[model samples]
Target: MPDHVLITGGGSGIGLAIARALAAQGHPVTITGRRAEVLEAAAAETPGLFPQVMDVTEPESVEAGVAAARAARGPILIHVANAGIAEGRSLRKTTPEFWRSIMATNLDGAYLSIRACLPDMQAEGRGRVIAVASIAGLRGLKGAPAYSASKHGMIGLIRSLSEDHLGSAITFNALCPGYVDTDIVTRNVESISARAGIDADAAMEIMVSANRHGRLIHADEVAAAALWLASDAASSVNGQAIEIAGGQV
Candidate 1:
């Protein structure tokens, strides 16, 4: 059997896109999320997608989820750390609870998930670890200190891991994208509108204009980058953050 691929936050958005793309490539994929209904529904709609309800923020949940997935499928050869929350708040407005929450889900979650699935790759001597980071990781995003910091930490982790396994077959890389046209954007439209006292269209336009091409990026675009990074062709693309921001970032 071909090695299985495990993706966190695979119920929707870029995670779902990457899950479907990998599944269509004839790879058994385990799609994980915090919501069982969402995962089950997504798995039902797509073939070769196995639903594994998990909270990546929790170490025990990640370990158990991967073990269960391995029992059902084979060893996981690809691990996509795509589970994260996107929210922007000024440094003065950021609270301790909010900061910890972002770190727990965005940074700590990736660390735990990779640590759990990496052994399978070591046993087989080959694997792909793709993290769905953001351009904010490459540069601090204004008004979103926690989110930016979390993603920066995630990319740093990927870079360090690639160096730790420099001569190994396992490859570690990150995909840094600008504002994507996902549910997050939809939610952000309303939040930004309310926060900035602007109309919804204006708020949406602000995000749409954030990309250099003056349009929101499709989830498939990010998925394509991930697909490439997960392939043998990307064997030498380790410790790098490939930007897919519609134009140069």
Candidate 2:
């Protein structure tokens, strides 16, 4: 049997989708989030999914949570550092607190997650590290400098980790997805609608247009990408940021 997989923020949206996909493939999947109720509900419905309440932004919480998961399942061979916040503000309005919050959740959380899971990966001599980054990691996203910088740091972390363990069986990659249809998008639409004084549909349309295909990418599409990266076929695909945005013609 394959070693267990651990995914952060796995109670909903992209992370949950990825966890479900992996579980469907017969891998024991531990889905983690700060919300105990949400994770418990998801675990109850999913056959192979095990819920672990974890706040990625807290280092001690991560270490303890990861140990609990390890005790329940086997060593975590695949670590998906997917927990993150997607808040944005203009540079002029971005406060130090706001910046730190973003970094703590997006970048530092990823680092902690990786550090916690990497030992098992190192012991096993085979592993996969997947970080769910955003298109903003590839290019500047207007009005979201903090979010973009955090994602960029995530990708950089993956790249550096891959190099640090070069010649090992473990592979690290980042998924840079375009705007996907998720709860985050829904929340953003609401915020944008308020900020721009536009209707919800128009605000959502602005995000849809941001994708090259002129439509929001489905959560499953990103999940499929994660599934592939976790598979043996992607063993050679390390130190790269795979883009899920529809390519230009």
Candidate 3:
């Protein structure tokens, strides 16, 4: 087993929850994000959590950040590519810039993060790569074609990597969670309300209704799936996109 775990976009939401869960299990956790303040605050509150300011969209930033994290906590035995941006834009309104922005963060970010961590993992002959994808990856989301595409790309990357490393100690998988109760959902509520000219409560209901259980999934629920995937019992569970969307997808 590896001594250290690294999580991108770990300052808040699902990433933070996974970091905290691993830390509770005695892993030295390094959390990286673009915001120094948020990372610092999260680290301050968590005993085993360390913070690194990294923009996953930038290659140099990812390389340097991964080096710093490795130096701080030793080789990253587990990596979570969780940094992403979710937006709701109709296909007709989605601009080139908007599509690229979402792809850069959700797809390119995961690629960079995994690439930076793979060298050490391969050298050690064992590691875990868990991507925090979404239900959008599995099916079309009504107003988020770009976001859906990005997540689909993420799942594709994970699946391809898993095949490349087949029979090796390393494993790669993706967590596809449905509407989670997080700041992203909060922001989306406002966006949905404005876009549809509806009240915020009604906009929230639209999201809530997307889940088969008629409610938002919790961050910890996704975190638990991540922990399970990282365990030795899941060594054979490779190249899979595990859904946590209350049977939505």
Candidate 4:
């Protein structure tokens, strides 16, 4: 059997796009998310896509889910730590709960997911770990100190892991995208509109303008980069953050 690819948050958005891209290439894929129905529906729509309900924030849940995936589809050769939450709040208004929640999902979740998959990858002598970090990870955003910090921590984790595993068959990389046109962006627009007391269109424009191309990115664009990173061509591309924001940082 082909090596199985596991994608967290594969029920929707960029994760779903990556799942579809890899599945079409004949890779067995296990997609995990918190919502069973959404995952099931996505699996129904995409052949070779298997659904596993998992909460990445919980260590036990991650351990069990990884084991179940390995049992059902063999050892995972590609682990995409793509599950995360993005929200913009000024440091002054960012509560401990808010900061912790973002950190738990964006930082802790990736750590747990990657840790769970590393053993199998190590045994197999080859694997790919693609983390869905954000451009905010590379640089700070105006009103999202907590979100930015969490993403930075994720990149730090990926970089540190790559260093620790240097010369190993496994490769670790991060995709930093700016304002992708996903459900997350839609929700962020609504939130920004309410918070900034502006119309939705204006709020959306704020995000659109953040990208160097002056537009929201497509999910497939990021997926394409992920496909490349998973390919043999990217075996040496470790500890690097590829920017998909359509221009220089």
List lDDT for all candidates, in order: 0.94, 0.93, 0.95, 0.95
What are the per-residue Cα lDDT tens digits for candidate 1 across 91-129? 888999999999999999999999999999999999999
- Compute the lDDT of residue 181 as modeled in candidate 4: 95
Q: Mark the regions of model 3 whose C-alpha exceeds 4 Å error after superposition.
A: none
Ranking by lDDT: 4, 3, 1, 2
Q: Count clashing residue pairs per candidate.
A: 0, 0, 0, 0
| Candidate 4: Cα lDDT at 184 | 96
lDDT (Cα, tens digit) per residue for candidate 4, span 53-167: 9999999999999999999989999999999998989999999999999999999999999999999999989999999999999988889999999889989999999999999
Residue 12 C-alpha lDDT in model 4:
100
Off by over 4 Å in 2: none
For model 4, the superposed segments whose C-alpha errors exceed 4 Å read none
| Candidate 2, lDDT over the whole model | 0.93
Any idea what lDDT model 4 has? 0.95
Clashing pairs in 1: none
- Kindly report which residue pairs in candidate 4 clash with one another: none
Residue-by-residue lDDT tens digits, candidate 3, 1-249: 336999999999999999999999899999999999999999999989999999999999999999999887789889999999999899999999999999999999999999999998899999999999999999979889999999999999999999999999999999999999999999999999999999999999999999988999999999999999989999999999998988847
